[model samples]
Target: MSATTAPASEIQPLPPAENARATRETASSAAPAAIRHYLSLPFAAVLAGIARYDSVSFWPVAILVVQILLAFLCDRHIRAHERMEPKRWAIRYALLSAAAGASWGAVVVLWFVAAPPANEALFVLACIGVSAMEFIARCRFPYGYAAHAALSLGPLVVLLLLQAAPSSFALAAVCICVSGSLILFGDTIANLIAESDKLRHDNIQLIAKLSNETREALQARDAAEASARAKSTFIANISHEIRTPLNAMLGMSQLLDRADLEKPNRDYVKVMLEAGRGLRTLLDDVITLARDDTMTDNHNDSDPALAARAVAQLLQPHAWEKQLRLSVNAPSTLPRVAADPRRVRQVLLKLTENALKFTDHGGVEITVGVDEPDDDIPAVHFSVSDTGLGIPPDAAETLFEPFMPGDASYARRHQGAGLGLAVAKRVVESLGGNIGFKSEPGEGSTFWFTLPVANASLSGATDDSDADAEVTPPSDLTLLIHTGKLRVDLALSRILESFGNRVIFAESRADAAARAARETFDVIIAGTSDAEMLAATPGMRAPLLAVLFPNDRSPASGEQILHWPAPPRTVYAAIRDAAIRKEPAAAQTRDSQEVAPIDASAFAALEKSLGLSTLLEILQSYIKTAENLCENLAEASAAGEWDEAGRVAQDIAGAASGLGLAALTATARGFAQNVRNHEVEDAHTLRNQAQLIVGEHARTRLALASLYPDLAA
Candidate 1:
């Protein structure tokens, strides 16, 4: 007889208890459909037995009716108690199936023994059909199918053999063969079903495991982002807190330098100033590290040669202090590169600073050139080579990691937090560039990086030979600057005095007007608040260069204006331009209909100076201020209060300029100009007034959402 169970190797075996439960469940669920086939068979057999009443007696009919009742009862029991006490339930199911087979076997035997030789073949055929039905119904359970086949065919084969006739013996032989074949086929079917179920279980487990892993990965990513945000916030707040006192110290040091003190005391103050500046530089490096990757994409076309020259100029004093020759070798006509000028300057500054710090005797050289073409994208290459102590072999791998200096010994001569190279690497990579170095121990190190050219065609279009040329204010020019802020006064006095110009401070608009009337000054510098009043003063002939603050108004006339906190060189250039221009340039007009919502260059400048968190705070403040000013402007305009409207418009313009909202700034400036000139009654000026109010709200919202998405949310 075929084995009652599948081979163990053919399918992974479940635990004994689970195997039993699975078998019972599969059998129970299959029982309803399996029993349906037998249900009709028992009723049909009873009808056949009645038609052959002479040969098959009432006993056969009674047996068929009993089989029908047993089928219903077994189905009901299987359905009601599926998977309950699986081991006992499976045994009971097999026994019931076997009993049903035996009942059919008894019917077949009784009919065959009573019938004549001619009808004996009919009974044998009936026995074979019932045995086939048994195989079909119970094949999924090998033990059940085997028991059913053995009991149903066993009695028929024996009775035929006992007849002692040729036809009866042949019939017995056929019954034995059919029983063996059914048992073999049923075993194969059972093995296949078992394999299918095992595969299903494995797949379910695999899917569950994968789902859990994916969920964990997402959680880890979110956690990492949150931690990064928190770190950035902490660094920005601390940097801002430190800068306030640091600035005061540096400013005091500058004040001390101007005081009449002993030589030793002067040297002491100088050292204090240098130390303070160094600390401030380290704080800036930390802030740079805290800035997010989004800064990389906020760049405009920049001149590498110009940036290189600028870095050299800024570091010239340090190089002089160290007695090292600092030089820049860059072509004046190099193509503009796709990088932020300030960030480019920062990377160069870090690299050059490191080179200067390490090298004591020899000089540092900066070289800029076009790198070899890479995939048809031209790139500008910049390198800072120094004759410093080259990197040790052991430190090469971690040289660019933060705080990992080339020489980490406590007694190492170099002094730094070792964050310069790390900051430089980050800035370069963020701009989609590669930075690396070549060093030889005890010889020198050459650090290099590449930035993509913004436009290949503009390679030879720019000439920057004069970029580093000093702008000398006309010799011994008398300049009058009107300002109340000490910081501004000190800064301007230093720059103007450095160029050998006489600077006169004005306490108020009236004082500035009186100074201009009496002094015959070459250039008059005053805040925008006093620009208009001073210009209207009788006998005032000096060109008025209006110094604009964030909350200051642009003069209605074609007066020169300079943004506050400008580079000293920029201030010099502006002064030179103002002195030479024979006439006030017609007020430069912009397309009133078109302007960018945010000036990317200006926004980047703000972010670099203020840090992201502080910049966002300023933006939030500006949004609130702009909204209120817009409301005030509308009210004043409706009341036909031109002076009040003009003041509000100027406030709006200043606030817009501070946040780099170009569209809002232009609209508000035009409205302010219109109000100042008493043109508010005209359609054009009224339209500009409406635009200023509407554009302020729209532009500020856009700036808030784009620059600081977290706060916008």
Candidate 2:
């Protein structure tokens, strides 16, 4: 079992510390098996000596037996204490190996000297076989193997050389070569064992480290998910709370504007309303940022031109206040775009407002038109160019990061939360569009974005009533409307009257039926409940327009339905279509008077300027004020104090507008109007007002409290 040395290149050397540890482990592991081999080999030697007993003495046999007994003792000790340190065990095994080798050498020397010259070759062969067996057994421990090989063969070699014969010298030289070869082979085998052991140790350590890192990574992921959930809950709750009072304030202010006040007071109310709306806009931006996922839905066909025009109108008041001209320049024929009209309006509002806020001298111009096709999708381009202080080069990199304004100085003239561009960028990107800007400091800036055009088929299907196309109401038509709620009735009446239409109101289905029997109207508009009944009424000759609320079921096929809370233009378009039984011709001009639910920009500014603590206090104060006003309103209404109720509604509108709660403000404003018109005498009318105000307040409070749990607590 002699070992052949492998090529040095095939064996990788281990570091000194690792090599030492490897060697100790290898030796300890091989000890038990090597001990068993030692015992067997010595037994074989003893049996051979007995076979040659006629020619040799019993001394050699006795020596072999002694070596076997020693091997047995070492094996027993190793098995009994398996937990013994490798290095200490290896040393003890080496000593046992030395003793075994010396005993074998003595037996060989005795036989060689006693045997005849005829048996000299047999003894030499026997010595070589024993040396080979020793090498195989102890090779894993090179030092121990080397000692055994040399000791076992040394006496035989010396005896042969001292004979002074050529054959004897040749035999001695062969023994020397065998000894050297076995020692070298043992060393090579030892290195291979060391490298193997070191590799295993390294692998174990690497696996442990990987497991630990994986555990930490999982923990981090869990923590992140928890934090995300908490953040989402907070945003939803805070948004509701903040919006409640804001709506109340804005609604009250709108109602106040309608009161017979002096010009100065009217002007102040207008300013307050505008400021409140602005604040609501800012709050919306913050909410949008926190709820980024919401922006991904509702991509519908929209007119880029109309959206641009609406933005121009919405900000025109601000422009007028700043004494700057604001105009929208859109192509007469622009393609309908694939986008969310609300989001588009939001983006435009942000850009234009930023432009208006920054510009000190020149006007802001909004341009909308078609751009070169991209990926075979036609796109509509919208740009807001303002003669304001252009963005600085240094601020360009972080300009689109939320709360990072172009002018970040604490004393900067224009105050903002710096979320306009950030929000615009996010919205455009989420809508599958690109947004960027070109600016020269102290000169002006142009911010632009592009939305893909709507599919040709969709655009063509509704081509007659193009979203950008205006539809003029038939001023000479006599319209009869079935009234339900006071607010809806008043709003619809005012809208229809402004267009020069002679409108008659029906209080119930019976009244509508009666009115239909008497009047020959061009168009009959009724709430969803009375639409069918009025249409079946005797002597009814006019086309029916059903006003559907949000929760209303879908109208029957071929039925003309108008969604409530629609823009005035939409109402006119519906009426014109119902009256003529065809799409109305596009008018030259149109105006949008719709108000947004919240103003994101103003809210952001308030949040940034007031710090979290101060803002929290403000929110707390607003909640308290709103609660008091709600109680005051209920008391005033119960006492039939119409004037006091109107005053209370005005106060709520002021508070809501200041906080940018547009929806609540609008509701409160309508409630106040109903009071002023003495329309709250009816139980239904009074109940409706109370429900609207209370519902809005509850929503606002819940939203705010959710956002700031501390406030709720």
Candidate 3:
């Protein structure tokens, strides 16, 4: 369709202005040479054929001159058409055609009178001219030019050619009409072919554009996801690195508490313990934030109670220090949920800590409940609301954004990174839940999140209200506590007692000295620097023993001390050696060699018991899924779906976590987090690193399993 085409209602008899405009539009879209050749070729051929009739015949010369004039007119019209409107061009062309027709009609009538029964060769030449002209015109403008040229020129030329042959004039007229109709038919076929070709070309372009966009999109998404995963990994690694040393410090301080240290020594130990706890709290927050930032739609709602409990334990000290009331309103028989336990705890603890921070007089409350629904899976809602300072309504939405606080002056009044709500929101959303709040200024706030329950609780799982003992201590060996959380001390005490080990508690070195003064024991276990005071106090009799923290370096002379870089187990082993009669060297060597190489695969039995096989299966499935992801990455990159690619990478990270590929899990988690944070520029390297970790972990696990066959089983 032409741009000048009007509606049917607006369609009027062809006026010169309208026709000229239409012609110009059509001409501008086509090659001028094409239009000229179509219009002039037939006339030139007819005139040349007539020229053979007589060099002296004035009719032939006059026709040749008129043909030259017509050609000139066509050239002028085409040039003018470039500057004029389509309607104007069309009108001019129509006028030119009429003028050419009138002149040719006069020539035809004159030729019939002078040259009756014209040569067959002349008529053949005219026929050929008309056929060639129509063909070329049809090639140029299939719909308009070709139809008009064939209709006007074909029949007229044939009739003019036949006029010279009286006997064949009637037959020629009939034949001309048939030939004109045939030209019209050929034009239609040609138009259809040309249209189909144009359509195919358009379709190819559209598809190519779409594919390119899809690929670009995928690449961008992958990049973003890779960045997020890197961030999560960094958080986890940093947390672990800090935690190891913190554990040692806190442990030693706890041992100091048991010793009979002077007030200054006891106070110093307490300060160190508090600092270590503070560091732990900070690390936990970072980890939670990282995990939350990397979460996606497919994130599981089930989180381990043990892990979540660990986070809560970290914040418990902070709450105690503040002297704020705190209570966990979890169901007596709360079910586990399919969520990132680390993230969930982070969110809850953040809310609790925030509540405690602002509430000088009120207590913080946390409730964990399940909503019964028609579906098989139950929804568990955990709400941590506090009677602390409430959030302004206007700032509610922005509060979840990083660095945006409830009050602009909060930084001056309270000390925090202002990431609590942001982290909480991200964590909740990641765990397939929502987080919301209700608060009034100067009143308080309530923050809540909901997730699906992982499984029904066992009857006895909730029997131990104070967190069930997780670590089991060895029996037949004397145990000593140096320093650590009260709960850890309590748990360790219970575990050692259950194992039939004699357990002793001392707040300072002086206390241990008093115990030693009264008994001649097999071993004396010292927790911290209090060992110095304990050693100074002349013990009655016992092989002196000291329990070293993971990073503890100080040593007191005349005492056998061991640093438990591997913690409790190694500490107990050292105590056993120091307290009991030494086993034969050969037996000690055998024991040491027996437990070597307990790597990832060695824990397969435990893994399966914990239902981690599903994770392994997912890892195995990654070979296929990853292929799809890669393909999707390419497509998304081409399509410019950067966000989608990031999501895909996150999926891979989560799957890696299930397989117990911690390193890989960290890497993927980092990438996903970075993407979510809009840190995409660094995505490429991160994603590659993440993939490598996953691959390496898989191989490491398999190799370890191979070395220790029973471990895998």
TM-score per prediction, in order, is 0.57, 0.51, 0.43
Residue 352, candidate 1: alpha-carbon lDDT: 94
Identify the leading candidate in terms of TM-score: 1
Name the TM-score of candidate 2.
0.51
Worst 10 residues of 1 by lDDT: 463-472
Against the reference, the lDDT scores of all candidates come to 0.70, 0.69, 0.54
Q: How many backbone clashes does candidate 2 have?
A: 46
- lDDT-wise, the better of 2 and 3 is 2
Model 2 misplaced regions, further than 4 Å: 1-88, 95-140, 147-200, 295-342, 359-362, 369-381, 389-398, 407-415, 431-433, 450-713
Mark the regions of model 1 whose C-alpha exceeds 4 Å error after superposition.
1-22, 25-87, 99-141, 150-196, 333-336, 373-378, 408-414, 453-455, 462-713
Best by lDDT: 1
TM-score of 1: 0.57
lDDT of 1 at 604: 57
Looking at model 2, residue 474 earns an lDDT score of: 45
List candidate 3 segments past 4 Å from native. 1-276, 291-324, 328-346, 372-378, 392-394, 405-414, 453-713
